[model samples]
Target: MDFRWWRRSFFGAFLSWVFFFLRFSCSDKACAAPEYTFVKEATSAPPVIFYDYIIIGGGTAGCPLAATLSHGGATVLVLERGGSPYTNPNITNIGNFASVLLDRSPTSPAQPFTSEDGVYNARARILGGGSAVNAGFYTRASTHYIKKVGWNQKMVKQAYEWVEQVVAFQPPLMEWESAFRDGLLEVGVLPNNGFTYDHLYGTKIGGTIFDKEGHRHTAADLLQYANPRKITVYLHAIVHKILFRHIPGTARPQAYGVIYKDAYGVRHLAYLKRNSKNEIILTAGAIGSPQLLMLSGIGPGYHLRTHGIQVVVNQPLVGQGMADNPMNVLLIPSPLPVEVSLVQVVGITKFNTFIEGASGLSFVYPLARRLAKRFRLFLNQSDYEPFKVPPEDMARAVDTVNAVVNRTLRAGIILEKITGPASTGHLELRNLNPDDTPFVTFNYFKEPEDLRKCIEGMRTVISVVNSKAFSKFRYKNMPIEALINLMLTLPINNRPRHATAAISLEQFCIDTVMSIWHYHGGCQVGRVVDKEYRVLGVDSLRVVDGSTFYRTPGTNPQATVMMLGRYVGKRILQERYLSRRSKHKN
Candidate 1:
């Protein structure tokens, strides 16, 4: 009762034990609790709990579907394996979007894109999914692809409108797009009809420079429309399995609930509980969508059997028909040193100070897209040969680039072209477990056309850069010494150049150049899901992300994915999952 030493020592020791107990104490049974009973709360009896719909993967398509369906007053639970988007700073910053590609760590382990064989491709893994962490580039699909995907004008146009509203897309401001235009013009590649390239179906192609706020807009901004009570977006909930139950007598089965793990590593089951009544939609993008289905026994028989996973349905197309737009950037030494960081092409530079916040290179999409469209239309009308590029298309592309260069003083260029052949890829289950990353094989250049076009495009880039106009920019003498060193290190270009004492463009491409991080394709048409995006053999499950593309678009896939999400959401809403649930009330 008397000592100051006793008070300090005994009380401090007691508090330490309390802190340790609170931090680490937990029942082994609770930590390893199975799917059910984890969330059990005792009422007068076992409380009846049910959800009208359960959606796994709160990614690009999943978020929208969850929002749209939840608005109907039915209980909707969105299970995302990643953490809450609120904590991620990089998720909202447009500049950091591209940097996410460079991060291949475990917290955001790089998802398999290209095969372990040749190409390099990177993907994002967070709550907002890829949208939470992707470059803010947006482009709608070409008219040909839209029609091929089995969408009529009415449906496609409607989807476009939905995308525009959500992303707040607009033509680049004149000042913003002007630098890009100037750059093309300086090189004499400007198109005659102006730069905004709108297609036959009104879909446009061009880069997004400045956003509507006069600030840059990202997909995180668009997907965040699910706010307050409308949508319950849960993060750090990785879906382990999609619970399915077959019709009592029939062979067909329907998905009803999802079993997932929470942040605390506690597993919980949001069971449908109703027999053949609830709907489960798999909007988990191309890669994840197919992988999840296979985990649940819904992919190619041989592959599933080989992986030791029982095949619920031998849907051969489950992970086939993958396609991605092969991206290549042509680089040239600029006469003037760019003070801005060029490590990766991004951000609002001082050049943006000219008009409407900042307008030069950022706002040129409208002008550029218009020109690309006219050229595309002209090519389609003529007898187009892949290997033999028509003189007309070449001249047109050259003119477009020249016009843009001259307009923007920012020289030393890299023409990014999506002209390569669209090769298919696949994602097979590497393991029977859902949590494991699957083996993805892009098989990028499977077709001869893909190889030829890529080679041709590289040659075309060389021909233009080595021309008379660029040679005068003090660049003739400065022949990318760094690139030469790279070529020497790698045997990608072993053959002799066209001339001696000078490196040719073809050599640079074959050696130093590599694929842009734009890998796409895999869960494409005829392979992954049907025309409506419904998995061919499964009921109520679908894929609606870049993975759903059969042939990669000639440009970026953001706008196309947005359009698909809207299209699927409308179809689901029109069909009304609520009405189906009402029927099960009895």
Candidate 2:
């Protein structure tokens, strides 16, 4: 009766069975090749071509504009740097929102980068741009913002309807999102503007790009308006520079064409129709637009000269006044599993803060643990400064930090974004290389009021979590009180000496706050572009993306960005028609 031998034999059999199961369970499946009949590969495009309009960066604004222009009978060419979003399953599925951003492939639709101040950020490189990668929240710009920008209200409303028909939807509120909505209302963020797309104060459930089936309909879908025969969309076409020609007696340079490279590294030129009032428009995002402008020698004269680029225009404000909405996130672990959801509930507090919540098993288990560990380190270490860490260490730190804040798998996240902040940052060219990303410093919390508002937001989150609505779920082992105390330890500049501490609030913000990715300005109206959305100091060049925003609206900016694209497209068509009529009269 050898009991030990029997036990060892049982253990060996169990191990062998587990390995056999894994071997079969992990077998790879062959995937079918994706078809992209709507888009043309850059390598197949002619080396030199002409179009009635050459739109660079087929993104959020670019896609819609190309569709509108082509529908109006103008021959359009859209040059996009990233591949088609249709074939990327990570982008097409709403459940993979966070995972899509973690894609670090060289040609990933979402390009990840660290800002100059060491804040981890990402920009959309695909045809649909941010709309393809962002958390599916959708809300129109505030009426105040629309009037401030002086847009035609009627046209703007129509534009919103046009976009909503294609990409916007009303998400079904599940258990987690329902609880969040109740919590927001319990905290006095009242008058639940139920299921409205308008940007109003107080709690509201806005529109989403995710339909009932959890599928994402992106702005790229709006390309249906494009006349297929009239529009030529070249995927993986990276625009290097806007070709400008000097006209005698004109004070500014005229943008005539653009030089770009295909996916195969072959160069090509796209020119505007000769003897016609053709234009080259830049619909690149906030960072890409400013970076391209500087690369084309349209930024500060001194800065361009230092980079050995010949100055075309001395626009000092071209890369200045860059601003992004700063975000602070608090994770609440629960014993009960929270239902999966995106942003279906929002709290618009009186203190100028926008609070949104989401919870679910959205991320892979391994990634969730790594992110939780990183966040614990970030909050626990009082002296943690990402900039001081080495590149390798900083990357690990950022990954951990971003994983917790950005993903909503296994825990609930309360994200608070400052709707408006006076503090602003600037973008500068790192080098003359077109492949180099611009240096972004989002001088967050530089203003004392900014920190005060953020503190108020943190307190609001505590109130919402403690409310009766979240009573069912038990709070796990997070040191919520300790985190709140750390926020209170921040030094107030104007407060009494005893009330203030040696650790300045500004530094705490620099260590904790991250970009919510609602970037705007750099080429703003009244400074860089006119009210008509045309880039100043350059003829036939317009910026029709978020970069042209006078100020970042007080909500998720996708709706407004799309509205502006439609608005500007209508204006361009109207102007063209008027010109033709005047010529006939002459």
Candidate 3:
């Protein structure tokens, strides 16, 4: 075999596998059937001519809202900007979550935006939206996040109960649990606090996990279960604008209907019939929800003018206070030669099966509870108060982190900087194109404190690696500098070498770092929507999902997002129905 032929064949095979993975594995699971035929059906139909409550964007927030609102006995129409993940091959495989970053997969429609910043990473162009392509790790909103939005503990606690009732929370079976446990115990980084699969929030460990059936207990699952007989879920439908009316005497504006486009590219507007009272809910998520509002003239007047969009309401809070989890995976080598396990692989299969049949372990709840009990070691227990400790304690913690980063140089642990100061980014409109990717400018680590946090995170990981238990495993930290050097040496796809040289403690806070693709916070509380998630100046519109969060929780957002969906859904239903009877005389 000549070198040329070998190289050509190897690269060809590699690319083939990449394309295959992108096609069949999207939903953090595997699939047995195509996930696009339904999208075809949705697109072929003419625009919806009638609906009492039209929920746009069947993503995280939209899914639950659609399902819950339909439970109100109202005629509901769910308009998804993308195709159904159930039918899209790109959404079943878990591994495709990483690969979809480079190319436009089946779910990611042509985005109308791009960014010099690396903040808002990728947008899913399918039915389940980001839920179909996310890491599947589940944690609810941090207390800081809830309070930041002016939601009291009682409200968030209630939201958690509502969310947990719908989502199956657990890890995989015994083997996966053992692996997670052994991995943590082996490193001796066992958390000192109690874990939570409960009502409380913060850095408490145990999070909601996917069961063997692949049902993630996400907004998608809840929506399906909570869906009402009157609600119609239409995949591949994108809402274009919200139809509004200026009340003749009142100071507030009223929403009457919505304009949306089906998969066939045909546009249609469903308006409120004369003398008919109707409410249009915009659960389109952080980006889509706000974008739709802006398109309908509901954002900052200046910003709207720049995009040639006429102003509906001069709500300046639109598109501000975006936050995301600064993530970086700390890679640890196996003590023994690595063995490929189908545990994660099984999750792939289960997710796909659910998309096709909506049954099996995917529909069970006990499976999640069992799984959560197994991976309790790596859980962190903290109140996650922003200023819990004194300033001196924080300063000392910063010093401790610096010391660990320095000491790791002597030990063999190669600290891979994943979520560092340089990972800070933001979400913005790339241009006037709504379908375009947003301008994601992550000026990561432009601030010094952020750099200290990354260094502290590195130190924390090292503390786990240096423990007595981990030493027994003899985990040799590979020479990470070598890996960094290799990446720098690469001709193409070479990233900026942010950690090229070690810095002194005096300069630690000033250093830069990279991102981990954990994008968050474009429509946070106290800004985008009020505590109840109602759009500030608009009636019957709300913002939910990751974007609505004030900040990314210490862990992943899937579980938290599910909670938001459920909480917001219940609140909307209550305010719309329960509060109404008291006001009526009939």
Q: Pick the candidate with the highest TM-score.
A: 2
**How does candidate 3 score on lDDT?**
0.47
| Candidate with maximal lDDT | 2
Off by over 4 Å in 3: 1-41, 93-103, 109-115, 118-120, 142-162, 172-195, 198-209, 213-218, 272-277, 333-335, 339-426, 471-477, 480-495, 498-517
Candidate 1 ranges with C-alpha deviation above 4 Å? 1-49, 84-86, 95-99, 109-114, 169-220, 223-230, 273-277, 339-415, 433-436, 463-474, 479-517, 577-586
- The residue-by-residue lDDT of candidate 3 on 431-532, one tens digit each, is 654565555555555666555565555444444445444443223333222222222221111123233222222232223222323456556567767777
lDDT by residue (tens digit), candidate 2, 240-354: 9998888889888899999999988999999998744568889988988989999998999999999898999899999788878877655565556666667667887778888
The candidate with the higher lDDT, 2 or 3, is 2
Candidate 2: clashing residue pairs, number: 0
TM-score winner between candidates 1 and 2:
2
Please give each candidate's TM-score.
0.68, 0.84, 0.70
Error of 2 at 217 (Å): 1.0
**Model 2 clash pairs?**
none
